[model samples]
Target: MTATIDRAHAAARRGPVARAYRFELVKLVSQWRIRLLALACWIAPALFVAAVSRQSTLPVDTLFGRWMHATGWAGSLVMLGFAGTWALPLLMSLVAGDVFAAEDRLGTWRHLLVAVRSPRRIFAAKTLASLTVILLLVAGLAVSSAAGGILAVGNQPLVGLDGHLLAAPDAAGRVLLAWVCVLAPTLALAGIGLLGSVALVRSPMGLLLPVLLALALQLAQMLPLPVAVRLALPGYTFIAWTGLFTSPAQPGPLLIGIAVSVVWAATATALAYLLFLRRDFTNPAHDGPGRRAVTLGVLPLAALVAATVAVVAAAGATGPGIEQDKVQRSVATAFSHLYRLQTAQLNRPDVTEAQLAATAACNKGGGRLDARGPGNDWRCVVTWHLPGIEAAGTAVYQLDITPDGRFMADGDGPKEVNGYFLVRTPTGDAPNPLWQFDGNVALLPAAPKG
Candidate 1:
């Protein structure tokens, strides 16, 4: 009978509860913590950009994909990764943590609770307000990062991982898409911070703890952690999937990374809700047996995951060469579409013995007929026949590889011919998909062709 009366009274206080929740926004913004958080979020990216500009380790030329990423949209994505990893999450935590703790710190939480009459409703309102702020901060960071990256670097052609360069227009579109991908990872961390804030009521360090945790998880990801465990870490979607900018794009890893970020965020949020519901308001919030157990539960899980990864790595390293076999299998499977070599050279009724031998050798060598220096296995080849003078001419072109792969036969034969070749990797005998080459390459005023 008494419990029913108390429940009815609590239900009747809905108007004051709603007002207290709205006031949380005004209270959170006025704090110096909010100012510091905003600065941290903005400055972290700016510092990274400065570091990139001043750093000497990154070369300006084609040292693999380094120069290309530093040059355009790729550069901006790099800055966003570092910023998004901890900066955005930490900023949200700063406000969210204070939302609960600030009331306790002011010693006004008790008074507000009596006015609101419902603890659960107040908690919900506080959480929603903080989450809204987190979303805005992240959006601001994204816009600023894009603007800075385009201005500092320029929207130039992105040299893809496959070593092909992309023009500025294409690069711009990718930058926008990549920035949006970061939101999932950020949201997960923000959820974690909110949970910590709710559980630990008044500690300023509660906000800082999630930031430290985010950093730790990132470091773990770089180590020999299992793929399953690595996926749980925030911001991994940025790297595992972002590498498609490399040549021969692979989306498998990226898809998996996004899946992992989504799952991690969802699970963390569920655990948070459980903690909030079970907590005792009248007990005055000590890190007591209840909170201690929740914290300790994470320990065995971390160790078990860590040990499993270490054992798997050690076992794989000790065993017979499975990794090598996997690579060989993947390469062979990737090239399975390549076909047998056939040639119809010039007006000659039959190809000369030399031409036939060259084609045979090239086929056996996986399409690279480079009889000189180191060899390559790309199988797109082009051969041409024309009457030629004493200049170098195309004896063979492998159209099966990207970034154009082939060898030219220097013509001492005076066949008076010019042959051009266009290659795309491992595609079977089509007459020509399309060929992009100009024999003259460049031209000037009235140079007579004899």
Candidate 2:
């Protein structure tokens, strides 16, 4: 009899929590709000893909935007970048923020706990349900976007950041990988919404707080903060997937993004769990005074702002810009690569880096100013051979360096070599070839003297 009683008690304990989780899932699915949101997630990408399919020009400012009209895969990646800006956060918050606060709004928390006999169980159930909804939403968006892209644009070879063409199958795999990469930061946003839901106990505050926080962090990135600080923000992680679309696939940024996202999500979820444990759901009046709640909220935000200011102040205002020698070397090397790509497009014989015998001399601002800093007045005189034209020419490049050592150079030279360059296509037609020295290029370090 004792053994039978113990078995019955164990079954009883398991039954309620399982039932509560099921109830939460059912409740979420049954709601029109969630249903509509999920439907929108599925439909929005299709509409965006269709609308942008007709555009003649590519949005090169955004990652993968340059190739959107070229392939359905690129279209999906472009949308992913757009979504990460705000849509991901907003969509995640919509459900996560409401999971707990909705009960408070309905005045059903007491009943919910009483029925389950454990707030812990209810919290777990609701959290699990919210997570399940998020997973479904993410999957829905990924599938719809990928399908829409494939159907509307068709798969084509993608141009990588390094100016190499990625085969269609390889590009498709990377695009899907990029979508998966975004989920890490999306979960962090969900955690923030969950924290707001439990801590604020108001649906509006829960929904808007996370979104506002994300926006604030994004704005903070625009300030002259240290790279480390900027990298720590969840918003920075959103673009880390761009590295995946590059040649040889740089995974460093993606790894850092995942690490930072994990930290933020873990911190927020832990804080939410602790706060939820201490709350008294029996009496709504026991939820504490408004002023005290406001103080608690403001304190953290103020601390963050102060810390940012202090770090910026300590780091000082200057960054090590590109050195003159570096600029000269980079300009020569880049010109070689650019010319090589151009010649290859015309079915010319392979031009060796040695064959060009490229050389460059750089000057800053037409005067003796510091070339080791970012400025628009830098110039480089580059001389290289054009094997196809069987001639050599000197090009004067007007260069600008970014704080991060990126260089953009525009040159006045032979129109054939300067204004437009081509990439070899399988279809034997050059469509919208890249321009040399017309876009951002990384400065190459000076070769070590033997």
Global lDDT scores for all candidate models: 0.48, 0.70
Collision count for each candidate, in order: 23, 0
User: What TM-scores do the predictions have?
Assistant: 0.58, 0.78
lDDT of 1: 0.48
For residue 246, give model 2's deviation from the true position in Å.
Answer: 2.4
- What is the TM-score (0 to 1) of candidate 1? 0.58
Highest TM-score, which number?
2
- Estimate candidate 2's RMSD in Å: 5.2
70-161: candidate 2 lDDT, tens digit per residue: 77887787788777877788887788877888887788877887788787888788888988999888877778887888888888877665
lDDT of 1 by residue, 1-450 (tens): 999998998877766656766777666666686766666555555455545644655432211214423464655665565565656556656765456666656666567677766667777677767766776666666665656556666666664433345577766676666666676766666666666665566666666756776777767654543344444345566555344553344454455456556755665555566666666666554442354535733553355445544543443322211122222222222121111111222223333323322121134254234321212232223333323434322333332221111111211221222132222234532221112210100000112469
